[model samples]
Target: MKKSQALYRSVLIIILCGVGFMYSQSESVYQQVEEAVANSISKGVQVGQEALPIQLETLKGEQVSLDDYLGQPVVVNFFATWCHPCQEEMPIIVEMEKRLKEKGAAFVAVNMTSQESSKDEIAPFLQHYRATFDPLLDKDGEIMKKYQIIGIPTTLVIDENGIIVQRINGGLTFELMEDLVIFRE
Candidate 1:
């Protein structure tokens, strides 16, 4: 009976130790997420801040406004036709857009029209990437300046209430894209 009691106590200690280790690991993960969110909030346009208004025309000459998407989560991407990183990430962005559409998220691509050599370059770039969504044209780069976009291929995830939730400075991967839109709080 004494030996059995000692074995039970040892097993109990092992289980308690395992639980403590798991809890510590979860706490570490939580801390990392908190830090990442805090850092993202300090960048351009700022997270938790209401998005700057954008009203621009699409390649087909249709006027689109950010206000139009106010009640839905929006993914706003600022890109130029000539940007290499933008070119590489275009397909991934397009795929993410489709995936998030069912959940009522609107994906808006703002082309830095002023940065393009000619308007002609836009069509071929979109065609090559097979991006079916029409991109809004920032004709005078006024929208870009409003958002303080210093880099190409910058993407912002705005929540349903028009607040900027996440701002990505570079190209996106599928996993990051999922985290930004689908899995985020």
Candidate 2:
């Protein structure tokens, strides 16, 4: 009877230790996952920072640089032709540009052509949306990487002094676009 009791206690201790080990490992794994998510979420440039340099060719084949518009507010939108949200947001962006350009604000839509199949589609796409403002092509995706663009339809609002005032990750409604560029509060 004494031997049996001792053996039972030993087995119970082993089981408990095994459970504790598993719990510790699971906790470590959870922490690692949490850290990774936080890093990814914080990857993009923040507001109040200076806008990164961008020099690219417009669909019209003209070279444009962000520095050229530093004395006035500039709207830099990163997009791809194939992105549906980008297509949907173009009209709103066009209106926003019209309203803001009167106030001396510049708008540039940087096309992510590196991910696009053919550059031939860009002109037709712009014509379809009646996008009258500058449409720059990021042929090598360098500008997109410089901006840390994680998704399509990302817009950055840079103030006259070249400071980034706002960063938007998704499509913008007309109201939202107006609020961002006009009000900016």
Candidate 3:
């Protein structure tokens, strides 16, 4: 009887130790997952996050940087000429250009040149749309990837301090654009 009791106690102690080790391992995994989520939230495209720095040449060949517009509100759009939604968004953007500028905000369009069949399509598209903003050429798609842009017509409405105030994933109306960038207090 005493032997059986000692053996049972030994088994119980082993089981308890195993459970404790498993709990510790699970706690470590949970902390790792928590840290990864926090990092992603800080780095990814989100409203109130600082806009990533962009340096690229315009279709006109002039160089520009997002930093140049640091002290002014800016609208940063990622678009391709082939995208119908981007094409549709052009008119509203064109209409708002002058008005946004008057409100002390600069409009910046980043052309996803890498997605185009030919670089020549850009000039005509801009001309056809009567777009007033000079488009920054993202020739290698690096900027798009950096911004983690999963969709066309992604617009980042950045405030004067360079914090993204809004992230519009698809085409936005003129009134909505005004409400986002112009009419904001």
Note the clash tally of each candidate: 0, 0, 0
- TM-scores, all candidates, are 0.74, 0.73, 0.74
Q: How good is model 3 by TM-score?
A: 0.74
Global Cα lDDT for candidate 2: 0.84
Which regions of candidate 1 are displaced past 4 Å? 1-44
Native RMSD of candidate 1 (Å): 10.2
Error of 1 at 42 (Å): 14
Candidate with top lDDT is: 1
What lDDT tens digits, residue by residue, belong to model 3 across residues 33-126? 9997656544346896777889999988999999899888888888899999988888888877777778777889999998899989999998
The better candidate by lDDT, 1 or 2, is: 1
lDDT of each: 0.87, 0.84, 0.86
Runs with alpha carbons beyond 4 Å of true place in candidate 2: 1-44
Clashes of 2: 0
| Candidate 1 per-residue C-alpha lDDT over 1-185 given as tens digits, one digit per residue, 9 for 90 to 100 | 99999999999999999999999899899999999876665423778787888898899999999999988889998999889999889889889778778777889999999999998899989898888889999889898888988998999988887888899999998778878854566
lDDT of 1 at 110: 93
* Residue 111, candidate 3: alpha-carbon lDDT: 91
Candidate 2 clashes between residue pairs 3 or more apart in a chain or in different chains: none
